[model samples]
Target chain A: MTTENHPIDQLFKEKLGSLEKNPPAGLMDQISAKVAFRGKIRRMNQVKTAIGIAAAMLLIMMAGWYSMDQTRIAKNQMPLQIPQINTPALAKTNQESLDIKPTVNQIAANQHTIQTTPAKNTSLQSAKPSKSLTVQKNKVVSASVSDGASLLAAQTASKEPSKAAKQEENTVKTKAAEEKTVVKEKSKTESGSNNFQKKNPPLYFADAGVVKQTPSRESGKGNWGITAELSPSVASQSVSGATANTTQQSTVSGGMLASYQVSKRIKVSSGIRFSQMKQDTHTSYTLSQTSGITYLQPVDKAANLAGDVSLYLPAVSSIVYSNGMKTNPTDNFTSDIAQELKYLEVPFQATYKIIDTYLSVGVTGGLSTNFLVGNHAIITQNGINLSNGSTGNVRDILFSSSAGIEVGYGLAKNLIITIEPRIKQYLNSVSSNDQVNYKPTQIGIFTGLTFSFN
Target chain B: MLSVTQLEEIIYKCREENNGAQTALYRLFSSKMYGVCLRYARDSSEAEDILQEGFLRVFTKIRQFEFKGSFEGWMRRIMVNTALEKFRKNDRLYPVEEMSIYEATNWVDETISSITADDLLRIIQELPPRYRMVFNLYAIEGYSHLEIGEMMNISEGTSKSNLSRARIILQKSVAENFGNEKKLVKKVL
Candidate 1:
């Protein structure tokens, strides 16, 4: 172009030319490599955390399985000392039989004299029969017939009569002894019922026709035992038109547990559960809202990544189930929690049991809070009408859920090694900011150990 | 004018961690960006500082670029932001109220009509930092007085007044040097 007759524009253009002569030194390589290295470190740290969580979960599961197995074995050995009670009753029965045989023969020899001395012998014989009857009744009390004296007393009435009048007295004594013996036998046959039957009576089975029905319904309240568990979890949130974040949440919960075997394999357990939880949640905000997208001039794109400090409350209560059974290997020992959210976060996870060698996979979800936290720009539509004037408010809260699978190795009678992988997603919106649509989701792998007392 | 595809390629290369691509892109835009930075800086060195920092930020955040408009335009805004940062850090800006457009429409003195472009540029560079910043942003850079006022933390009226003062000073200098170019032209003839 020809120079402008207006010289000021030309001079201004010339000065611009001069200014171009000097350029800043290049430091791009240094800075770029540093930034990249930092990024790599961050990624590495994430991997390390994931691995650690898996290991911890595995440890917890292994411990639980080991403890459960130990409890089972201990339960199996419980009836060891208690069964010996039957031996004493058998010995007493033998002693009573011996004493009765000799006395019975002597009563047979005195039969004729017993008949001739009727009036005089009547009261004496009646008194003796009554005394023996009283003694026999006392011997048949709830106590086991383990005393030799009680059996000897039971044998005395069997002797003393062979003639008609004497035989009648003998019959009365014999009947009483028979009744006492029958009571003792019944009590002895009911050894199984004696233990638990006292605590829970079989009122429904009280019919005499139901003989041989032990009063104690073997409520095999799943061999009362402790359960230790370690489950590896993953939770995350994502933003629309931006990067996704996946976080790992590892937890170990277990304590002294008492289980009553309600059946062969089913048990209801109640105990204190103290849990240690660690969560590494990563959140990403798309810089779309802050970007110069609408500006007439160019601007750099913006994105923000932040980490959260998570805290979990301890849980306590009864664990009701069918047969101390792990319904879904991947999904075991889950607590119910309520939350709100804005994103579609799907988390994938793998978990392992160190002791039982059990492994499983699961998934869960949570929503991003971007719209809820920073600018609150996300406008929500109350699928229902809200009392507030605004159409939709910030959805800072998220709904979190998980589904998973588990694989385990039975290490001991009650111990198992397990691994479970799970995925979690936030179903709620993460941003109240209209400009951002983010949800939190995560995927993780876990390894742990579990113990069952069954 | 580069096609949108070409712009995307450049941006991609820069994001792929290519140093050469970054340097090339910087070279292509440095002149305009330096002009922008100069408007907010006290001197060329300060302007260069802003340019370097701004370019670094541009590369760092290249992934978020959502090609809403011309890529150059977007980058230009970043450089302006960098300049603003420097201005803010140096406390070189002040607040001024908006004046009517008519108040800012004053003309240069006819006495300086004969002055050369180079002489006018020298006068502009010599103005105080604030006046020079207002003049470069509003007049040379084609920024609206409202924008200059916002960028410099001043009212639109103050930006207009500063620009007017800058023009008056430049015109006076031009008048003083008005005869020099004529003498040089006569010598060449």
Candidate 2:
């Protein structure tokens, strides 16, 4: 690069043309760590976004399903018809009722059977007058048994010549007993409709050839679940009427849990969850030496010589002999350092529900055992690293107690999503000293998705 | 010395996130990149920072390179851009009117040749950021005034003025170091 042989351009092209100077040590590490950290943060944000979307989708699907269920239940809850055959036997009784939700066709079949039973019985007896009562009873009962004549067959039969008189009495008594049960069921249905107008009434009933079904409350008593939980946590220590602020970190925990429904409103659960905590701590402190040694590190040689008057033409040599490098005063030097610690924790917790419904409000408290996994420390000044080593005498095992309120929503049958804001209090010190007993309390908002195996 | 193929192979491994290859690549090109950074930076530490930042970008955006030109030249451009970015961040546009313009002078051949790379680098560093940028772009990098102006977000006239000011300062420094020269030592590097 020359401009009509301009001396300045000539000087650059000839004397100060190409250069090859090694960069100071440890620069590669800086670049690598920063790049890796950036990539990790990017990946983490993506995962968080994905999880958030999945949770939202689940919520939408659950809401849709719930509304669909409510619509179907409303259609089914319309008033049912009463049997006209035995109106006199309609009586109410005090007994714990069974709730069985059957298909719609089952209710129609019951009403048909009650209306046709008496006429079918009379026709059968008239057709066989001389046959024994046992034979006659068998003949009276139809193949589908829609007449419910099997109950009439169980009555005491008179061998008297007056067959019509005995038959009529037996028929009336059996019809009355059947009507009494129906009236009790009808009263229950009316009371249930008053209590829950939105709910569908039980369709199944006790009868010959109609299968008795158990209630859904019994079916919902599931005892086991697997939950996946994640939380961003911050830990701090209580020290001499002041709290030492620690950096915010995150933990991911999940495990299988077993629960016992001890009563209608209470449940006890225990689970083993694997979790972790990470802290990157930066600190500044004074470091004084007995007889101070000057830290003579390299400085910007170009910047140092820019203003010095006599230093431009220092004693002729390959390098400027004097006043080339600069030094910083270390007489009252302060040190800046970093330390990182990690722990893998196993938590065993119990939960008690207060308001258990479609949305349950619960109080959960538990203890966790923490195991130290990784620790690293590095001390650097400005940008130059001074020292790197290990931390000593740190406790390996620590115990902590955690308690929180968990609000859970049923996404679908046996699938639940919960958000729990919990606080953990460490019982033991992280350091191995009595005086430096740093007990940290951490607060975290945990989100979990649970699937139940009933 | 490593061959071009070897360097390319290291780059390939680096693309695969091989840490050893990344370190090898850094060892291969760091010195040259550091030299470029020094001319653009105010101090040695700032130069290291620029070099580090440039290497990181090289690794992150290595896939963008089509391998159409010299890899060293590509890395040199990144270093220059990194330095320029530092200036952009600080808005380092010193008022041109505030500068005391000195007359350009001639120096001795011995002085021209004898000026240590460090001494020349010092004089360039002492120039105001704008002048330093223009001098590096025009004199060392061989960018035209118009291109320098576009790159630095300044008018062509401002770029020319800054280069002239930088040359004046260097000329004054040389006149102090050693008088005029008849014949210069060739190829000092």
Candidate 3:
């Protein structure tokens, strides 16, 4: 549509085009009022959008920084992450002066499996000194054996093969004690036992607990410890009357746990945790039949005062609309509404270590009380935030029980990495609504890093 | 009476939302923009309504102007847009005829300049909203049919048709006012 040969264009161009006639009187006042109004509205809308974006960005940044810092702190806390109480005791076995004979002595020193077992003293010279130290192929395993008793025990056992013929002439009577009840320090030097006795630390057993305990460190029995666990929880809701399918998005739970070893193999623990159960109930609820015609405004004034329950009125002329618009009375609406319930859970659990080796396998069962911190039931019609509502008749206190198998690996001396695939069942309904008995259950694999205190 | 620099200073001050500068700025351009509003509107009161609305937009969006092009031209565009918005809202109500009339006629005869701008303005105002809006955008404002279509929210073809209809109507108005070429006037009638 090019204007190549238009005629009337020329006439209008000549006549009224760019005409500068004066407008009506006092028009400026009207303009002033309107412009001021527009400016206020525009500024308000811009401010609202800015605030929303800023809040979302701030939340994400804080969450990311927190996660990174947590990982770094947890990493710095494992196998011998705690300082050694006696360094010379740890260094005795690491001496490189050993020829092939002492190297065989190192293999003898590593026989901790027999030493730790009271029933069968078949010791294994375990070579894990620290979690950070990766196994070096040619490096002597003696560096990992911190105790002198084990080194002498291995050396004596290895020396006996050479002296087997003369064993009757040199019968050394050494008293070997139970694994936990203290064993008196004993060492038999090949030439003279005095040199070996002098090299062994006078008293290392009392201060030995200062070194970090690896979760499954064969000889490690931790006294006291703390652990932090994080898990992504999957929750499903079970109700009584109406059929509702509930789905959750991004349900994460994190908690700090503290444990005290009641015995050598059992630990009693308690901790504070944060967990949320968000349920999106996709349900078609039938409205009780109204006898008279009820005209609902898109933004009903009464909706705000609905007192803990909001009726999500949709913007449709098909039903009873605000401006006296009416339609056929009986139509059931099937829409989605998001209901979130947050809890500050306190769990009192006991863990029994089945095999406290390099990889510790344990069975854990816990009783937790989930305080119904927040329950928000927002009624949305076609994805519009109509109003704030309550999860009607929600019980404040909820009791739950959980059980899981905790598998912990000694990452370093004091630091242990653990994973527990746990399932929690609600003892009572989270919702007190008689018509809907909503009991939610969550299952997740909880990952944690444990730091030993003593 | 103000120089270009003085006008710009007033505009800058108006952007800061000074009442004095805003009134001064309004006084400076209101007359010329009112003339534009009159062409699009049905009467003086409607024209005044359009002028008031356009000026309100000008004041609210004063900060957006970087002073690159002509200030008057920018103001004119705002005024035209304000008029067009009014037209879109009320376009269906206003009466105009079918397009597809013959084109390539002599624009206005020897008596074209004899009629006053006000008289031509009146003839333009008499047109239905769509025809009047298209005619004013294409002829007076020097916008292309495509531009008119975009401004008026219509197709370029529709723009051209409306322009043609506006022209045929104006030709009869011109012929009747000058009282010449009885047959041509009757043909438009």
Candidate 4:
């Protein structure tokens, strides 16, 4: 019942089980090439994923920084309230001291009243007390002398004239000595008040007792900032050796940048940027078949990021019709092939401020390391996609240098809106293929929102 | 032929992705693997494709191969799986009509000896894709009907049926190609 013992199984196994045939030549080379290429692609994908995650984290950090900065600015804008003192009570004490007559006992009592006053009053309040005491001492001294003279005249009529005159002379001498002492005390009080005024200059106006503290404009200056920039980029390329006519197409570029202010007029920045170059070539091609697989082979090399059309078209060499049938070799086609190359660019730039003010202008220049992340080429005939593939000879890494003028306007205490018109030129050829030399140039007016961390 | 120690050394080098070692390994096993591919492939070109893809997988995934069982057996399994995947992608299984059972033909040893492996390979390749797969897995590879069903994504009954049909068609071809030769050999005897 076992199929193993069956005649047909026995026959085929005995004859074909150990059969070996030499495979066609050059297959090993093909496999090796594929393995290396796939390895590169795998590594590229890993790097791209890492960059993507890092970019996302950068954005989150920027958002958090911006939110915290706004809160700080709001707190800074709030008005400062100065402590109010009971000025009327102090004025009443001054009036009461002034109205009392300056006998030796009354003078001693006034000195005690001045010493007992609280020290927590404003500088003006404290100075007023000393000034008022000096005035009171002077007024009391003069008024006491006048009253004593009047009392001496009244006493002459009521008693012995000689006895009265001798008593008045003793009383006048005592009053004159006390007035000299009061005058000396008043001069000391006046000097003390002048010294207090000199030491504690009033921050608040005497008339308008409230203090309003506005945050200084210099508080907005910080060493670090994060900018999110975007631009509609115009991409073009120069070709040294290519026959096909190629036209540049407009694309978009943007990124988040972290900047550090090194000095008042100089700033350095580094971050990730995304850029793309697209080109369309109108060319003629011949349909070729290899091992029953159809291919659209270009007649001439096209000027592109890859520099050659063969690399793009040969990747998906087989051309399948709309009905899922392979195309015939006899079919010759003329079409426009569009190739787009995208890169993840990391730029190290420095900006020098020409005018660092609310409306600031700066000149920026830098070099960027661009990693090729996306490369795609597609052929379309009459709105139908004929074939799609990727450019092969495009370099994985490219170097570019950019220069621009940055014009920024301060929108808030911690925010600025900037517009930078930049021109980037590739430092090396985009293609690794030796058939053609291609270098792409890009111009973009980048508009960005910058948040400062002070 | 490589000794066990030498084979392990080559495999070690392959794990490091040494191109020389990879090429050496390919040179050692490619012919045998291509033979296996040819049985499952419709043509030499398809066999070459399978061999190329299979060797690429072997080189890339060499690190995953634990030195448990036979290395050749592991590689053979990869080649077969590669073929099966290609078959699944390229061909859809269609329902086959009920066929008459093919009884074993009695032939002289000389007539059987006259048929070469290439002739048998050609006949096997001519079978329908599913039947060819089921027959190869069941007959030459010595897999069970249930195992063939799982590998080919068919029911066990369907596997058995396909193997029977494949055998019937193969038997008719062998008989047609070698029946007259057997008669001539009998006449000479």
> With candidate 2 superimposed using the best TM-score fit, by how many Å does residue A271's alpha carbon deviate from the native?
41
Candidate 1 chain A weakest lDDT stretch, 10 residues:
A206-215
Give model 3's docking category: acceptable
- What are the TM-scores, per candidate, against the unseen true structure? 0.32, 0.40, 0.45, 0.43
| lDDT (tens digit, per residue) of candidate 1 on A336-388 | 11122222221221122122212212221222222232210110111210001
Question: What TM-score does each model's chain B reach against the true chain B?
Answer: 0.70, 0.88, 0.88, 0.91
Residue pair clashes in candidate 4: none
Interface RMS for model 2: 2.2
In order, how many clashes per candidate? 156, 4, 22, 0
Off by over 4 Å in 2: A1-10, A13-17, A59-454, B92-104, B179-189
Answer with 3 or 4, whichever has the higher TM-score: 3
Which residue ranges in model 4 land beyond 4 Å of their true spot? A1-3, A77-454, B93-101, B180-189
Per residue, candidate 4 scores C-alpha lDDT tens digits across A1-454 of: 1356888889998888877888988989999999999898778657655654454355445445544653684333222211122456544443333433233223322121111111211122222322212222211221111112222233333232355444544554465556567767887897998899799853321110000100112223346777777676897767655566778878667777888777777778888887888877877667654432334555664444455443222212333332334434465667777778889898899888887776888899999999999876766554433444555567899999999998876555556667789999999888887765777789998877666677
Off by over 4 Å in 3: A1-15, A18-21, A42-46, A76-90, A94-158, A161-454, B44-46, B60-69, B85-119, B146-157, B174-181, B184-189
Candidates, ranked, DockQ: 3, 4, 2, 1
TM-score of 3: 0.45
Q: Which candidate, 1 or 4, has the higher DockQ? A: 4
Error of 2 at A22 (Å): 1.3
lDDT of 3: 0.59
Ranking by lDDT: 4, 3, 2, 1
Tens-place lDDT per residue, model 3, A1-454, is: 3444355567677767778887766677777777788778678657645653444344344445555654684333211211222555344323321221222233223222112221111122222121001112332122123234434444344222333323321221111112112212222233356666579733211100111223555333546787766677897555433444545655667677777777666887877777877656555443322222122211211111111233322222233221232343245445455666778888888888898886888888889998978665554444433223445456788899989888887655556667789898988876454344556678977777666765
Which prediction has more favorable lDDT, 3 or 4? 4
